[model samples]
Target: MASGFSLKDQLFNREKTRYLAGLFAASHAGFDPDRFEAEVMAELPALELKQRISLIAEVLSRHLPQDPEGMAAAILNALPPPLDPSLSDDDFGDFIFAPLGELVELRALETAPDLSLDVLAEITKRFSMEWAIRPYLVHWTDKTLARMEVWAEDENYHLRRLVSEGTRPRLPWGQAVPLALSQPLPLLDRLSGDPTRYVTRSVANHLNDISKKDPELVLTRLRQWQAEGVQSQSELDWITTHALRGLVKQGHSGAMEMLGYDPAAPVTAHLQLGPGPVRIGGALEFDCMLQGPSDAPVLVDYRLHFQRPGGKLSAKVFKLKQTRLKGGTARLSKRHPLKAGASTFTLVPGLHRLDLLVNGIERGSLTFDLLAQAE
Candidate 1:
């Protein structure tokens, strides 16, 4: 509801100064107005707590464009200490105190190299979930990785936890970093067999994020781990499902193959012509059959690939939920009408490949000869 002024202006305005001064006075803290304002603004109050931390972040982001390190230090020093543990359940306490704790941790990460590892370890210990540290964790070069690896071996679970916990790709409330997702496998391998559940869950989430963009890579890793008998069924299930989600959605051939479905099985496809292809108006009907294996039920996905006038191919996958394997064979079929533009089309008459992709991993190709009649 509050608008008009930029976040910076809203933060350093007269009203905020008075409110901050009053807060300082109530805490029995001595304040020199000029110095206090300068210091406090650098580490702006989390006054609205998480609800308004974004606003504070905007103000800091704008003001500290050049010296994030110095600004971070000033913010950390300005925070109130942790609130009494007993007051954690109090609503007002959460709004007032929790933000202070979180802000301290956030700034601690911003000033990580200057802060002792022990100090960073302590902050991570207290605010493992709420603290924002992804920026620092992601920027780690090989040199920093070496330093972190040493910390990963520390006896303190918190510091050791930081190695996995801080770099988690799917960590709730943490930013998703694709590069971190790529590099975390080695770190996860180091911690996978550890006696701690805390570390293993982080490993699982890291694998989960990787599965989205590169299902094959995750599958390869899982297969290797399974071969070694090092990965549990639970880990395999998590990785397989997450990694295959996108492929399944798109009905990619590799995904179906990984899932153990055959795509090249001989099948009959029937095409029911609709209004013939016109400039931009036409539709077609497609019906197809998929045979299943003798021993188990088969799940099949359907895809249609259209060739354009320029000889380029575009494919769209569709899931056929009714297909099922029975006895020695599965009778899988579907009837769908494709809209002209919705279905594949070529601006010019030509031969095109229409592929039926199964379970996103297997493919069946069909050729269609199209001729465009002049108006």
Candidate 2:
């Protein structure tokens, strides 16, 4: 080992040394590593980016296992703002900064009550809905409820974006916040008539999620919203489709009743089983029909409730559009393939119940057995 290495010499000696120095400078503040590294990695910017990411990952991995909270804070503090602000717009910055920000907020949640709300608000102010809202929604609490309620009224388009995007139940690539599920009517009431198309789309998705769990409530709200006449055409369209998603797909009798349609109209369903079931692989198919009165046009929605390996039933709905019911006959049909995992693995091996919900209420049911077969 060298007897007396200068700070300058130490930094130039190795990649690890450079990384450690950067980490320390960021943690301590006022020591400009960017100014210093301008010369150290001047010739190889790509290498610099890679080394920085690796260094951050290594530090996080080493410390998170022992002190996730402290480690998270350190990581956020250690992130260097991009050397060129333009470079910040790229995915590399997102990869480096997004996780650091999310982890910092999550850890803050663990250490400080309601910290996520403030952190999330700051993040929304800085980034778009596509980036910040998901993390905040997944970890939301009543502690942040008042703040979020206020955000629902924000004039900023992005903050308004947060209102709907954060509360969506089935947001793709996003975690579902169950708490928001119970009291959506108020939030929906606030955003249902928003002028922003971006915000309205999220409202529709949120309503769609609600429809699956409680179609009656969704339909009630839809009726109330329609009666109040406070909604725009876009809002009405969103609410109508989402509130009826579950019922329409399942062809629930009650759902039809709510939609001002008669369920007593003749209807038929057919089930077609695929190749024999395997222990870990197999699929199922369904077909159905709806016969309308001589002069009335009928819309039939259908869905399949699957019973998994553990005695739990999961329902998935599909839309069947509109068809003219010739007084004599109107045909409605559907096909579905079931896969293994959370949705299909909850039903136990014994006899299981498969129900067909027309609008929002069950109209028909069938029993089927799941046997553990050889692979």
TM-score of 2: 0.53
Minimal lDDT window, size 10, model 1: 88-97
| lDDT (tens digit, per residue) of candidate 2 on 323-372 | 56566465544444434444324433555445554434454566656554
Mind giving the per-residue lDDT tens digits that candidate 1 earns over 59-119?
3333332354554444344444533333222212222222333443454444554352434
After superposition, candidate 2 runs with Cα above 4 Å error: 1-97, 104-119, 125-143, 167-184, 211-215, 247-254, 266-290, 301-317, 326-328, 332-375
All predictions: root-mean-square deviation over Cα?
10.1, 11.7
> Which candidate number has the best lDDT?
2
Query: What shift in Å separates residue 260 of candidate 1 from its native position after superposition?
Result: 2.7
Q: For each candidate in the order shown, give its overall lDDT on alpha carbons.
A: 0.50, 0.54
Ten-residue region with minimum lDDT total, candidate 2:
85-94
